[model samples]
Each structure stands twice: as structure tokens, then as C-alpha cells.
Target chain A: MRSRTEKTLIYALLIAGTVTFLFPLWWMVAVSLKTPEAAQAATVRGGIASLVPTDPQWHNYPDALMQMGSVRWTGFLDALANSVVVTILATAGTALSSSLVGMAFARMRFRGSRPMFLVMLGTMMLPAQVTMIPLFILFRNLGWIDTFLPLVVPAFFGNAFFIFMYRQFIAQIPEALLEAARLDGQGWFGIWWRVILPLTRPVTAITAVFTFIFTWNDFLAPLIYLQSDDQATLSVALNSFRNQYGGITKVNLLMAASLTTMVPCILLFLAAQKQFIEGLGKGAVKG
Target chain B: MATIELNCVSKTYTGDVRAVREATLAFRDGEFIVLVGPSGCGKSTLLRMIAGLEAISGGTVAIGGRVVNELPPKDRDVAMVFQNYALYPHMTVEKNMAFGLLRRRKHGGISGLLFHRAERRAELAAIDRKVLDTARTLGIEPLLARLPRALSGGQRQRVALGRALVREPQVFLFDEPLSNLDARLRIEMRAEIRELHRRTKASMVYVTHDQEEAMTLADRMVVMKFGVVQQFGTPGECYARPANRFVAGFVGTPVMNFIEGRVDGGAFVAADMRVTLPAARWPRMPAGPATLGVRPDQLRVLYRADAGASSTAADGASVAATVRSIERLGDRMDVAVMIGGTRMTARIENDDRLVEGGSVLVHIGLGAAHLFASGEDGARLGDAHDAG
Candidate 1:
């Protein structure tokens, strides 16, 4: 009876924490479905009417989507396209390049390899803030001031943290597998492509998902680099929903646009959640 | 089939730690040579060096009269089966077995690959046929579509073999492939491997730490210890006429009994025990300190000294000892006895009179004993058959 009561209390606390965490998402959906007056009223001092929509405005989605694009700037549609391109390319670049570099550091034996790996890991200690201005200067010199190359191209060079993760993950795979591949007529690159890369599916999924979410939701980089409104990502364009006075013009429209921006990240996390958890412990024992 | 000749090969890591010292060996064509030793004995390292998976630190390895010191593993035309059955985990059995052939195939060049696609298609079909044939030979054809994770241990072992067989490389290197299986499966796979060796007619270099596995599989085995080859001979020769005390003790079951004592005049004596050597076994003895080794089968543990005279070895060499333990094996038993504070075991028939704490007479079969020079790593002095 004591254990049962403890389990019930534990479950009750978990449910409370879960509801607290999910409240904003529920509010976002509620505001997106509310009428314009109701959404505007929600912006005012704590109004209970904003909690639930009395009369749901289903047309608010299309009305808000139409407000995204205008003559002065390419609006929401263009921002969505820009985010898609950047996210997909950056995720691909991060996954492939990071795993390749990781495989080299993990499996190959060269002179000073240990020190090289240490130096690579040491790069992770440097904050992105330290390199942001230098990178901006470099990208400006490369004629990349308003282009997506500033955001997408750096991913191809590999992330230090992701490479460190891949290196550690690849290191635990049996040495005999690589040796067997070598004896079976596989060159170093061939062995990595054929054997090492194949066993890293779970890790690859986790890396790809994280890269997708980071590239999609990134606001500061896009705001800094994307000069034209046409090339702006969804994260930066989400700011356009408000008027010049910093008060939302259509509170429901802003909620709708913001909710749309978060959908891909949520779906991606849902899709990769299984692989993310499996990747933590699966590589240690599986073939 | 290829003949492998290793001339004084040695491996030394940094800080002057030697893993394999100057080792000279020669394997005949189509011979199954097994390198057997305890763990950390450098047997697997030697096998890897032969397969070109490891760089040779010193000397040269010549396969079929061609030196492979500078060649990479792919260029050396050798295949290895690892201990863990290192199958490409994501690939099906068919793709795993065909991987080597796929990598080694050439399509003339980039332009030929585009212009002559028919040739590449034919090559792919031929590789598929080869994979199927090898899988059928190993009786894993039905599992061609299944991933390695779906197979049983024995089936995975067969797939590992099939992967090597499909390549048809010049030489086969196996690094303790059956070490992971259970006892009964190990025995079953041992026979199957011997059968596979016979059918393939390929020269195989097998490495194992298990002495029994090495003895049963090897045409001629290389016994190693402490990075050095202790002895390299046929299993019969290693068992019957061991080159030194270590080789004698390592290659037998229940272990060979060693009595560290001195041979004074004609008999072996240590502490309070002395066994009179027969004149025929040791006539002209010139020995100081020596270690005597006797096979368990050669010694007889008699219940009574008077009754032992008629049944035991001729020349009547017997010592009084208390029975420490008797392990029964139905028809035969392992009787461990304490002879004057020294413990020795003798394999004899399960006699009814033997009991723990009871004293018995242990007859020393000097005619079949091995006399070695004193101290560890000692040279064998002489055998009973040849010394007299």
C-alpha cells in the first residue's frame, strides 16, 4: 500500500510537470484558433477569454498566411522556402561531413593522431560568440553578406561537438570489423563507407535531427546575415507579424505563423525520437 | 594454394615492448597451419602480419615466393575471418559475402563505365552467382536475404566463412573464429572447419589460444609463449616428444606433471622422495639439477606396493603418497596424490581401493619421462628412449 501511494504521487507530479511544460504550446494553438478581438484581448491584461476560443476562426490560417508576403519584402512563403533549403542542406552537410571526420579520428592510426584528436576536441571549448565576428568578416570578404552560404556552408566543414560524438561512437565499434574489411580488399575510404558508416545509422539519425532543428530554429544567424526580406528565414520573418509600435496587429495571425514554424521541428523530433534514444546505448553492443 | 615463409619476423611497439620476437616459420602449400598460444602470446599478431592487415616491423613475409612487406591487405589477396564474425551488420548475407568481389572489380575506367555498361552488368551478375555458390557450399543459401542480426551463432560463423570463401583469395587467415561458441557447438564447428579446409584446398593460417582446438585442427602447429615460438611441429610430435618443458606442459590435457628435483647418480631426488631409474631407461647418467616431466598416462597410482609389482611398469619404481583427490571419469579417473609434500596427478582406471587420505604407491614410468635442464625456460636434456 505504501509503494502504491508513492507510485501515485510520483505519477501525479510527472503529470503536473508535463502539463506545465506543454501549456505554452496549448496557448499557441488556442490563440491561433481565436477570433481577432479575442486574440487582441489575450494580449491585454490576463483575460480568461483567451484560454479557449468561443467562436473558432478557421480562416485565420489562410488570412495569416496571406499577410506573410507583401510588395516591400518577400514574406512568409519565401521565408518558409528559405528555411527548408537551409535546413535540408545544412543537415546533410553536417551529417555526412561530421561522420567522415569522426570516422578518420576514431579508426585511422597516424602519427600525432591522439594529439590531433585532442586539439579537435579543444576547439569545442571555444564559444561560438568568440568566432562569430571573425566568421562574419570572413564571409563578407567572400562576397557572402546577404547569401545563405554564410549559414549553410559552415556546416560542411563539420561541427566540433558532433565530430567528437561521432568519433567516440565509432571508436567503440569492434576493431576486428575494420580489420576484416581491410583483409577483404577494402581500402580505408571503402571500409569507412561500407562498414563503419553502415553501423552508424542510429547516430546518424540523431545528428541529422539535431542539425535540422538547430538550422530551422536559428534566429540570430539569419537575422544578422539575411539582409533582404525575400531571403529571410521563417524564424526572422516571424517578427514581421507585429506592427511598428511593437504591438501585434493580428495576434491570431502571429500565433498561427509561429505555430507553423515550430511544426517541422516537432515532427522531426517525433520522427527521430526512437533513434535518438537507441543511439545512446545501441552502438555499444550491437553488431 | 600458397606457401607462406616467415623469416625472423618480429613486432615491437613503442617503449621497446616486444609483442612477437624473431619468429621463423614456413608453411607448405595447402597446409592448415595453426598458431596456438595463451593470451598475449602474439599468435593473432603474427596471423595479421601475414594477411597484411598489420605492418611488418622486421624481417619479411613471402607468400608464393612474392614478398608482401610493403603491400596493403587488399593488394595481398588474402581474406580473414575474425573472432566476432565481423559481418557488415547492416548488409544482408548476400551483400556481405559479395562485398569483397564488388570492391575489387574494375570497369575499365570512368569512360568505360559509362560506355560499356554491359560489361559491368555481367560482372555484377557473375559476382551474384559466386556469392550464391559460396553460400550454398556453406549451406547458408536460404539466409542470403537475411541480415547478420537474424542468424544464429553457428549460422553467422558459416556466413563469415562464406564471406571469405566467396572472394577465393590466395590465402585464408582465421583469428580464433570458433572461440565464441558453446562447447558442443565449438566441437561441431571444429569438425566443419576441418571439412571446409579439405574441400577448399586453400592454405589457411588459423590462430587460437585453446590447445585442444589447435591440436585437432592443425596440420602442423606453432606453439608460442612470451612473444617467442616455443616449438613448431605436428600435434603428435609436440605431444610425444616436446622440445622443452613448456611445450610438454602446454599441449596436453590435465597438464603434464613436473617434479622439480635433481638427477643424482641414476635416480631423480627432491626433498624426501626418490624414484629409482631403470638401467635401460638411464644407464650412463650425467645430470646435476633437472626437472622431471611425466605424462599422466605414463604414471600408475597403485593401491598396494607389493601388488603393484606385477601390474605396473617393469623395473619397479614406486613412491609412497597420500591420495589428495580422485576425480572420476567413469572408466578412467584422475588421482591426485601427495608424494612427500609434492603433489602429482596420475590418470589410471577407477580402482575400488583408492580413497582420499589413504596412502598408495605411485609407480614412476621412467621409460616415458622427459628430463629437462634445471630452472624455467630450460632445454630438454634427453628423452628416455634416446638417452640410453
Candidate 2:
């Protein structure tokens, strides 16, 4: 047991850590409400006043959203729609393919399975940058550039890390359960669909959530593949906010746009984390 | 019900590690056969082979007089209840029991496969009836609507049994199904399993490491060691006349006592102690390093001073020993005594005559003793040979 003083000290440290982590979020909301001139003035003054707004400009969100519709970039709603489309497709694709490959690797036995799994794990060592050029060329040859194909098609092929995670998760399910299913007249696909899939819901949800976050936050792929502004995702649009024509403009609107863009992800994670992680977990415990 | 037969079946893994070797067993239709041994003794492997969950490395497996080596578990006409009670946790008990039946049935009958909605509904209702009836028979009717996680250990076990029973297969394979339960629950489930076996004609091939479980449940038990089938016979035959030293030591409770000695001039002698062998049962003494095995129940305790007054078996030997310890088990007690340099146990009714650190006479009736070679795999000799 911790002493009273020790407990107080630990709590104080934790509160400090939380505040440090949340400071950027607070800064984003505060700056989003400030006038552009006040933001610049506070930046020049360099004090605690810079951490907060002097006079709030409540119309910056509407103004930023309206400016997002100009010929220079896709509007906020367009980017949001693109993000949703890519994230949902990518998440579903990844969940299905990853769990299938993982279950095959973990449960089914065949020649070269060991070497194949090791090679799959080996691919996790390489960063996306290593394959970026080749993938771009491949997409170009297939006439997939400036389309969602480059963004969503690769997810269906299965991700190595997600497959490995799913494999580890599915391996913990008892072999007897699978055998029992087989004895009950289920073929391999039937067992996977009826038995393995339901047992691995928690892992599938986790993989989907991760894929959703990764596709939403991904900037390079969309920036490189999506040539037209209408097809641009939020990350590419956000990048265009500061680096367009080599000058950061309308810092207040940028903050407002950034805050609004992150809202769906935060709300999604908060809404889904509990049901995915906790709801189906109690069934796994054997009596 | 099917008569299952294995003809010199074996399982060899990579690196030439054999899990089961040349096991040949034949079960009559509706016979409850048990495969009994210690861990890694290939009992469960043999059971799995019969269930078609494992690939046969050698020989043929026949169910209902038809070879099924190439068949998968789904087509093998067998149902297995696992040691862990492999219930589908995400489903209700009714669904778990009905899942297999639902998958196998197409409409209600062969004539209804292409028929309309009424046939499908009737088929589903039939499945529901089978699941509910099996649940009722297993006394798990109330738990049908509940998930496996909501059940107690025994309840989950019953549900697992029900799932297998609902399928109504030709053979029922149980791989240590009751081992996970507590002692009392294990005994109760054992009895229930026995009763269920009696009520059904399906041949049951059960695998368990517990010798008692094997003995009590088997119509004929197969004793295995190091992946080899050592003996196969009725439980009474295996217990009374084991085939080898390992079987004798493994089959009985409190363990059979082995005293290393040799027969000299038709009498057994070890260090300063000597025991008389029953000449009527032995007739002739084979000359070799001998180990005499006696069950704890076979040894009678006598007071050192009153040893001459008792009517000891004519062919038996009496030895003076110091009482080492006494473990009282309600109506009976296990008394450990050291005769010369060797220690032996005597199980008798609890009596006031014996005390710790006291002196007593241990009597061994050679008529009931087993003689074997002096090693781990020694062959049984003398009167205790297999009577059949």
C-alpha cells in the first residue's frame, strides 16, 4: 500500500502529465476562437496571453469552412466525406483480410506455412517509404492514380503487423473448439465464418479501429495519389492550409479547421473503444 | 452404433517422434472402451485418431467395419467431448447444441432439399427438438437460453455433452472430459457418463490419465506407456493380473509395493529378510533377479508377539518390522512399515493395535503376490499371469 503522502504525490504527477498532454488540444480550441490579428499579436508578445485568446472570433469556423470551398482547395465537407469513405473501406478491408490470413497462419497446417509466416513477419521491418516509389509506379501503370483505388485497394491484401496481431489473438482460442466445430460437420470456411470469426470479434474491432485511425491520419499517400482537390482527404487539405504558396495564412482559421477535422476521430474512438474492447471479452472466459 | 477397429495404427511426427505406435484395438458395437495411461502415453492421441481429428501415420482405422483413414472428422460419424468442454462461448447452449445438426441437415429429408419454405421450417423445428431433448436428458434445459459463460463448471460440461449427444453419431469420443472438474464433481460426472453410456448404444472411446476413471468407466481398458499399448482387457483382468511391472504399479491405488529380491531354494530372499512363495501357485521358480509385487490391501498386519497365534497362509511369509507411519482414512488405514531395509505399506481396517514407531509383523501371502523381472518393463510371471 502507498502512504498518504505518496499517493498525493503520485496523483499530482499524473495530473501534471495529463495537463501536459492536453495542452495542445486546449491551445487548438482557444486559438480557433481568436481573431487572426490577435493570434499574431500574441505570438509576437510571447507571454502566457499567447496561450489564450484576447478577443474571441466566434465566426472563424464558418469563415474557414467557407474559404475551404475556393478553387484553390476542396471544401471541409468534401475532405470529410473522402476521409470517411477511405477510412470505412480501408478498415473493413483490413479487418476481413487480416483476420482471414491470421487465422490461416495460426490454425491451418500446410507445407511452407512456417517459412511463409516468417517472411510475412520480415516484411514488417521495412518502412512504407522503401516501397513508396514502386507502389506509385505500379499504381500509375494500372491507371489508379487520382482515384481511391490507390488508397483502398492495398488494404484488402492484408497488413503484416495486423495479420501478426490477429494470429496471436486467434492462436489463444482452444484447438478443441475448432475440432469440435469440424466434428459437427463444418468445413474449413464454415468453421472460420461461424466459429473463428465470432470468437475473434475483439481483435477484428481493434484492427478496424487502428486501420480507421491510420487511414484518416495518412497524409503522404493522399497527397501523392490524389491529384484533384475534389478527391483530397482531410490530412492533405490540412497540409495545404499552411504550406500553400509557401506562406502560413489565417492561423486562426487553420486552428479552427484542424480542431473540426479531429472531432470525428476522437468521438469515434471514445464511442467504440468500450464496446470493442470490453463488451465481447467476458464470453472468452471459460467456466 | 458402430464397432470401431484400429489395425496396428500409429502416429509419427517430424523428427521420427512417435506419439502412438502400432495400436490395434477392436470395440464391439455399443461397448464403452477406455484408453488409460500417464501423460504423453498416447491415449488421447489414439482417441483423436478414432475421432478423425488426427491423421494416421500408419495402418487402418475402421468404423462399422468400413475403413475411414481418408475421411475427415466431419464425415467420420463420430462426436467428441473435449477435456476443456469446448463450448462456443459466443452462443447460447441451444445454439451450441444445434450448430452441428443445422449444418448437416438440408431441409427435413432427402425428398425436401429442393422444396419450399415449409420444409425448411420443419427442418429447423426438428433441429430445435433434438437440441431441446438432448438438453433435457443432460439436465441442462434451464441453461439452454444462457451463454456458456453464464454456466457453472458442471453446467458447461453438461452442455458440451449435450452438443455431442444431439448429433447422434455412431461413435462418441471423450478425451478426458471430466478431468477439469473438482474431485466430487469428477466422480459425479463419471457416474453420469457411465449412466449415459448405458442408456445409449453408441460405442464410447474415452481417454483419461486417471486409472480409477479408466477402471470404473471401461468395459475393456487399454493400458498404454511411452506410446505403446501394454495391455487390453477387462478392468478386473488388468487389475488382478497386469501384463508388466509398469501396469501393476500404475493400475492400483496406494501403488503396488515392489521389493527387490531373489528366489533361493524356492524361497524369496532380500538382504536379511526372506519370504516364502506359494509352491502350489508357483510350482516352479524361474531363476533370475526377481521383484515381488504386493498390493497394500494384500498385506496383513500382526502383532510381533501374536504372530504365531494367527492362521497365516501356508505358502505366505512373515517378517518382523517397525511401524513407520499410519495414515487413517476413516474406516481404513494405511500403515507403513520397514522390513529390513525395504519399506512396505499395509492397508487394513483402523485398529488400536498399531501405533507409530511400534513393532509389528507384516505378512505377505505369496499366493496373491506377483513375480516379475527387476526392471521398469519386466514381464509378469508366476500365478498372477493373465487368467484369460
Candidate 3:
């Protein structure tokens, strides 16, 4: 009987915590539907009561959309396109390049390999901001400023962390596999392409997902690199909407756009959540 | 059918750790030669060198009378079954067996028209037939469609064996292939491999740490220590007459017992035990001190010293000792007897009456005792008994 009471109390606390966590999302949607006055009232009251608009103004979405851009459904639509392109390209480039580099580092032996690997690992700790300005200047000199080139091309070389992850994952594969392939009259390239690549799907998928998410949600890079109104990413465009609209901002349209930007990332995570979690758990064993 | 020869092959690592010293061995066509030793004994290293997996640091490895030291593993035409079986986990058994053939066909290495679809299908069908036949031969026909993960340990091992056999390579290299199985499974696999060898009669070089596997399988076993070949001979020769103390201690199950003793008037004397030596040649010595190597099976534990000698038991030579421990292993009991501050183990039949802490006279069969020179370099001073 006491255990039943304890279970009930535990469930009650869990439900309360969940509601508390979800309250922000509910408020965002509620205010998005309400007029600016109702939003202010909601902010003031900080409860569900203020969510009901004194006078619902649905035109706020069109106004916010027009102010951002008419290129698509909303300003968020253009930003979504930009995010999709960058994320897909970055994920593909990072996954392929990192896996290649990782395979070499993990399996191949060459002259000065130890020192070279050390230098590669050493690049991980160096901050990205340290090289940010220099990279911008280099790209500017190369006539790449105010363009997506600044955001996309450099990722083809791969980041050190992803490469490190791939290396650790690939190293766990038995060397005997490669030996067997060799005895089957396979060249080094044959072994790498046919055996290693085929066996490394899990690691590749995890790396691709992480790279996609990182590229998708990145606001700072787009903010610094993209300048034009048309070229601006969804993240930068959202920030610009807040700047231009000020107190008269459409809560619904802004919330809608913000929510839309998060959809792809959430969907991707849902699709590969099992593989991602399993990969992480496997990595934890090694760690 | 290939005769492989290793001419003074040596493998030394960058850290100056020599995994295989200057070792020269040759295997005749269709002979099963086993490389047997403890861990870190360079048997695996030597096998790898022969397979072209390891770079030959010093000398040449000739496969089928062709120098192959510089060739890659693919060109060596040697199929090796790894200790862990090394079956490709992602591939089914059929695909695993057909991989080498498919690779060969694609590369035009195996004379066939690559663009002819019907001909390719025929070739694929031929490969399938071969795979099925090999699997059937190994009694793993039902496992052809199964992945490695779904198969039992013995089944996976058979697949590995089938994979090697399917290629029909010039030589087969087995690196501790049956070490992963349980005792019963190991015995079964050992018999299967032995029968397979008899059927195919392919030149094979097997590496294993199990002495029984080595003795039972190989036409000749090469015993190694510290990257050097200690002895290479038939099982009977190695067991009946080990060249040195290391080989003597390494081959037997319980290992041979060594009692530190000194030679005195054609007999060896330790603290309170003495054993008369048979007629044999001895090394040039001052007759001061020596060590007697006796196998456990040679030492007989008896409750009474004057029991009627059985035909299997040697005629005389018995010594008294207090029983230290008795381990009954069903058919036989391994009895460790304490004699004069040194414990010597004896394998007696299970029917023998013996108990721990009870004093029993152990018959030291002089016919099988080996004597070595005392000191750091325990050279084979002489065999106490002559097999001739």
C-alpha cells in the first residue's frame, strides 16, 4: 500500500517536470496565435490565461512573412532551403572525407605516420574562432565573401573530431578481415572499398547525422558569412526579423518559422535515433 | 600441391624485438608440417612470413619453387585459416566461399569472358556447386545461407575451413584454427581437419600451441622458443627423445618433472632420492651435478612397493614418496608426490588406491628418464635410456 503511494507520488512529479519543460513550446505557439497586446499580457501574467488573445490578429503571419521575403511561403522557407543545402553538402562531404582520412590513419602504415597522426589529433583542441578571421580574410582575398562558399567548401577536408571518431570506430574492426581480403587477391584499395566501407555503415550514418545537425542549427557562421537579404540563411533571417519588427513582431509567424527550422533536425533524429543511440553506446564501451 | 621452402627467413621489429630469427624450413609436397610452440614463440611470425603477410627481413621464401618474399599475400597462392576463423561477418557462407573466385573472375585472372552473361552465370553456378560440395564435405551444408553470427562456433570454423578449401590454393596455413573450441569440439575439429588433409593432401603449415593437436595432426612438428627453432621431428621422436630440456617440458600434458641431482656411480642422487641410469652415452663431464627429466607417465604411483608387475609397468626401479595431492580425472588420476623437498607428479590409472598425505612408493621407470647438464645452460648431457 505504501509502495503504491510512492509510485503515485513519483509519477506525479514526473508529469509536473514534463509539463514544465514543455510549457515554453506551448507558450510560443499560443503567443504566435495572439495579437501583440495578448502576447505582452501573456508575458506579464506568465500563465495559460493570457494566451487567449483579447482580439486575435491572424494577419500578423502574412505581415511577418512579407517583411522577411515573398520568395516562398515565408522568410523561414528561404532560410530552410539554405539550411538544407548546407547541411546535406556538409554532411556528405564530412562523412566521406572523414571516413577516408580515418581509414588511412587507423589501418595504413607509412613514413612519418605517427607524427602526422599526432598533428592531426592536435588540431582538435585548437579553437575554431582562432582561425575564423584568418579564414574569412583568405576567402575574401579569394573573392569568396558574401557567398555560400565560405560555409560549405572547407568542410570537404573534414573536421578533426569526426575524423577521430571514425578512426576509433574503424580501428575496432579486425585486421584479420583485411588479411582475408588480401588473400582473396584484393588490393589495398579493394579491401578499403569493398570490405571496410561496407562494414562501417553504422559509424558513417552517425557521423553524417551529427554533421547535418551541426550544419543545420549553425547561426553564427551564416550570420558572419551571408550578407545579402536573398542569400541570408533561415537562422540569420529569423534574427533579422526580430531586428526589423521590434515590438510589433508577429508571434505566430516567428514561432512558426522557428518551429519549422527545428522540424528537419527533429525528423532526422527520429529516423536514425536507434542507430545513433546504439553507435553512441558502442563508443561508450570503447571509451 | 606445392613444396614451400623458407631459406634463412628472419623477422625483426623496429623495437629490436626479433619475432623470427634466422630459421630455415622446408615442406615437401602434400606434407602436413605443424609449427608448435608457446605464445611469443615466433611460430605465428614464421607462418606470416611464409604467407607474405610479414616482410621477410633477411632471407627468401620460395612458394612452389618461386621466390615470393617481395610478392604480396594475394600472389602467394596460400589460403590461411586464422585462429578466430576470420569469416567475414557481413557475408553469408556461400558468398564468403565464392569471394575469391568472384574476385578472380572480375579481374580476368581466371581465364573467362567477363562480358558474357550466360557464361558468367555458368561460372557462378560452378562456384555455387563447388561451395555446396565443400560445405557438404565439411557437414555444414545447412549453413550456406546463414550469416557467421547465426552459426555455432564449430560451424563458423568449418566455414572458415571451407573458405580456404574453396580457393584450392597451393598451400594451406592454419594459425591455431581449433584453439577457440571447447575440448570435445577441438577433438572433433582436429579429426575433421586430419581427414580433410588426407582427402586433399595439400601442403599445409599449421601453427598451434596445443601439443596434442600438433602431435596428432602433423607428419612432423617444429618446436620453437624465443624466435628460434628448438627441434623439428616426428611426434614419437620429440616425445621419446627431446633434444633439450625446453622441448622435454613443453610437449607433454602435465610436463616433464625435473629433479636437481648429481651423478654418483651410474646413478643420480638428490636429497633423499636416487634413480639408476640405463646404458647410454654421456657428455664430457666432471661427473659433478646434473638434472634428471622424467615424464609424468614414466613415474608410477603404487600403494605397495612389492606389487606384482603388470606387463605395461616397467620391470624394477621404484622410489618411496608421500602423496601431496590426487586429482581424479575419470580414467586417470594425476598424483603429485612430495619426495625429498621436491614434488614430482605421476599419472596413475584411476583404479589405483592412493590418498592425499599417504606415503606411497612411486616406481620411477628408468627406461624413459632423460638427464641434462646442470647449470644455466641445461644442455642434453645424455639420454639415460636408449630407444635403440
Please give the lDDT score for candidate 2: 0.86
- Model 3, residue A107: C-alpha shift (Å): 3.9
Sorted on lDDT, best first, the list reads 1, 2, 3
| Model 1 misplacement above 4 A | A1-4, A35-37, A72-74, A244-247, A280-283, B108-113, B266-285, B305-316, B383-388
Alpha-carbon TM-score of each model against the true structure: 0.92, 0.88, 0.83
Candidate 2 residue B74 Cα shift, in angstroms, is 2.1
Q: Which candidate is the best by DockQ?
A: 1
Kindly list the per-residue Cα lDDT of model 1 for residues B196-305, writing each as its tens digit: 89998899999999999999999999999988999999999898888888888899887888889998877777765676666676676786898888888887887774
Which scores greater on TM-score, model 2 or model 3? 2
Q: Please identify model 3 stretches exceeding 4 Å from their true place.
A: A1-17, A31-47, A50-82, A108-122, A146-148, A185-202, A223-251, A284-287, B107-124, B262-288, B297-342, B347-363, B375-377, B381-388
**Candidate ranking (TM-score, best to worst):** 1, 2, 3
Candidate 2 docks at the CAPRI level of medium
Alpha-carbon runs more than 4 Å astray in model 2? A1-16, A34-78, A109-115, A237-244, A248-253, A275-287, B107-116, B263-280, B283-286, B304-315, B382-388
- Greater-TM-score candidate between 1 and 3: 1
User: lDDT tens digits, residues A1-287, model 1?
Assistant: 56988999999999999999988888888899988877877867546556787788888887777787564234877998999999999999998889999999988888998898889889999988998999899999999989999999989989888898888899999888888888777777878777877788788888899899899999999988889989889888888887789977888988888887888998988988898889876758466
Tens-place lDDT per residue, model 2, B1-388, is 9999899999999999999999888899999999999999999989998888889999999999999999999999999999999998889999999988988877645556556668788889999988888888988999889998888889989998999899999999999999889999999999999999999867999999999999999999999998999999999988888888999999989888888988777677776567667666666887668889999998888876754332334667777778999999999999998877888989998888888988778887665678888888798875624432
Model 3 reproduced share of reference interface contacts: 0.60
Please report the TM-score between candidate 2 and the true structure.
0.88
lDDT of 3 by residue, B3-47 (tens): 998888899999999998889888899999999998999999999
Better of 1 and 2 by DockQ: 1
Task: For candidate 3, give the docking quality class from DockQ.
Answer: acceptable
